[model samples]
Target: MDGEIRTRFKTICVYCGSNSGNRAVFSDAALDLGRELVKRRIDLVYGGGSVGLMGLISQTVHAGGCDVLGIIPSALMPIEQISGETIGEVKKVSDMHERKAEMARRSDAFIALPGGYGTMEELLEMITWSQLGIHDKPVGLLNVDGYYNPLLALFDKGVEEGFIKTSAREIVISAAKANELLEKMELYTPRHDQVASRTSWELSQLGYSKPPI
Candidate 1:
C-alpha cells in the first residue's frame, strides 16, 4: 500500500473506437489504460463492443477483477457484437441518445482514447455536459503518442477566438499516459460557471438526482 493510487471515481466511462487503429500504439494505450483502472480498483463503462480497443480494454478490466459494463445502441448491436465476443454485462438502449445518457448516468468520470468520429462525438458531449452544468465529472483524454495534440490545439484556438471560455476549456484534462491522466483527473475541480444550474436540467430520464443545496 505504499504507492497505491487513490481515485474518487467508482465507474469511469471510456469512449473509444470499435476498430483498433492501424498503429500498435493505439492498442497498447488502451490496454495500459485498462490496467491502470484495475490497479486503482475502478470499474469501467464503455461502448459495447468486444472488438478493437473496446475489446482489449474491457477484457483487461474484466480479467483484473473489476466490473465492466458495455452500453450499446440497439441499431449497432449487429455490427459491434461480432462473433459473440461480448464482455461483461451488456446493456442495450433504444438509440444513441439513450445509450449515452445511460453511460453518463452510470459513470463518475469519462476518458477518451484515440478513436474516430464516434469517439470524438462522445468526448465532446461530455465536455458540453460539464459546460452546461449537467454534471461536474472530470473528462479526460488519454493523449497517447500525441494522438490528441491537434484536437487540443483546436480547443486552444477556440479560446483565442472567444468561442470557448478559459474556465470551460479547463474542463478537459489530457495526458500522454493513463496513470498521469488519472492523477490529474483526481485533482480536477470545476472552476467554470455553468450555463444553467445542474438541477435546472431535466435529467430525470438519465437518473440524475438534484444535489442538495
Candidate 2:
C-alpha cells in the first residue's frame, strides 16, 4: 500500500483532447480541473501541447502557481509550442511512445477528461499497464457533462461480455465532476490480484504466452 492518502499528489497525469469540444462547458470543465489541481498543489503531467483543452488546462494551472510538467514528442514540439517556462520543467522526447512512457513514470495518478482518439489511447495504455502490475497508481475518468457515460456503459458491456473482468473495471474511479473524482483517487488502493488475474486470463484466452513479469 502507498500508506496515508496525501491531500495533494506530487504529480497527476491528465489525458484530454488536443481539440476542445464544441461545448463551452467542456472548456469550463477543463479550466475547473486545472484550478482544482492548483488549489491542491498537485503538479500536472501531460502531453506538452499549447493548443485546445490541453493548453487551457496547463495555462490555467500555471496561472494558479502550480507546477506543470509536460512531456511532448519532438515531432509535436514545433506544433504544440510548449507553455509557461516559469511553472515547471518540460522535457521533449523522441516520439509519442516515449512521451507517454515518461508521463506515466512521472505521475502518481491518472485522470482522463473529454478527449478524442489520442486521449483514449493514452488512458487505455495506462489501464493496461496497471492491469499488468507495471504500476499501482490510481486511475480515474472525469465524466464532465456526461461526456463519458457512453464509454462507461461500454466498459460495463465489456464486463458482461467477459472481455473485461469486473475487478479490472473497478480499477477506474469515475465522477461527473473533478473534485469528486480527486477525492476518490485520494482513497485509492490498487488491487494487485485483480490486475494479475485479468492479465493472466486475457493472455490465455488470446492464446498468447503471458510474459513473465
Candidate 3:
C-alpha cells in the first residue's frame, strides 16, 4: 500500500482558462507549472488548444521535452487553434462531453489553474466523480495569486451550509504555487468512500428518501 501510495503518477489533467487575464502573473504561473510537470516527468493531459494560458502551458511542456496529450471538441478545434501535430498525441472528439471524458480517461490526477466557467465545470465534475467512487484520483487547485481563494471559501461555505460534505473538502488539495501543489499531489490518495458516505448523509439530511440499491 505504501509503495502504491508513493508511486509517481504518469499523467495529470490540467484545466485552465483559454483567455490570459490582464495580469502577467497568471501566464508566468502557468509556465512554471508546465516546467515543473516536466521536471517531475509527468505527462500533461489537457484541452487541445493553442491560445491563452493553455497554449502557454503546452508550449512550455513541449519545449521542455515532456509528453503532452490533448483532447478537443471538433467544433471548437479551429477556434482554439488546436495544435494537434506538435504535442505527443491529440484526440479530437465530437463534443464537449466526449472531450472531458477523454481527458479524464487519460489522466491520473486533475488540477485546475486560473480559468473561467468551462474550467470550473470540468473540475467540479471530476470532484463529483471522485466523491462517487467513479474514480479515485487526486484533484488539486493551483490558486495562483489567490485566484481560487474565493472559490475555496465558497466550498467551505458549502460544507457549513450542509450542501457539501466536509470530507469532500479534504479531497481537494490547494496550493498557491505549482511545485508545492504537484508535490502534494505526488502523495495523494482518493478518499472516495469517505466522500460518498458524507454525500449520502447530506442527502438524508435533505429528507429525501434513500432508495435501496
Cα TM-score per model: 0.96, 0.85, 0.85
- CA lDDT of 12 in candidate 3? 88
User: How many clashes in each structure?
Assistant: 0, 0, 0
Candidate 1: the clashing residue pairs are none
> Per-residue lDDT for 90-179 in model 1, tens only?
999999999999999999999999999999999999999899988989999999899999999999999999999999999999999999
Model 3 whole-model lDDT (C-alpha atoms) = 0.81
Each model's Cα RMSD: 1.7, 6.3, 7.2
Model 3 Cα lDDT, one tens digit per residue, 1-213: 111223377888999989998999999999999988877777798997888999899888888776888888889878887445555577888899778777877788899999999999999998887787556778999999999899999999999999887777888899999989988988886553543442344333223254212
Looking at model 1, residue 14 earns an lDDT score of: 97
lDDT score of residue 117 within candidate 3: 99
- The predicted structure with the larger lDDT, 1 or 2, is 1
- Give the whole-model CA lDDT for all candidates, comma-separated: 0.92, 0.81, 0.81
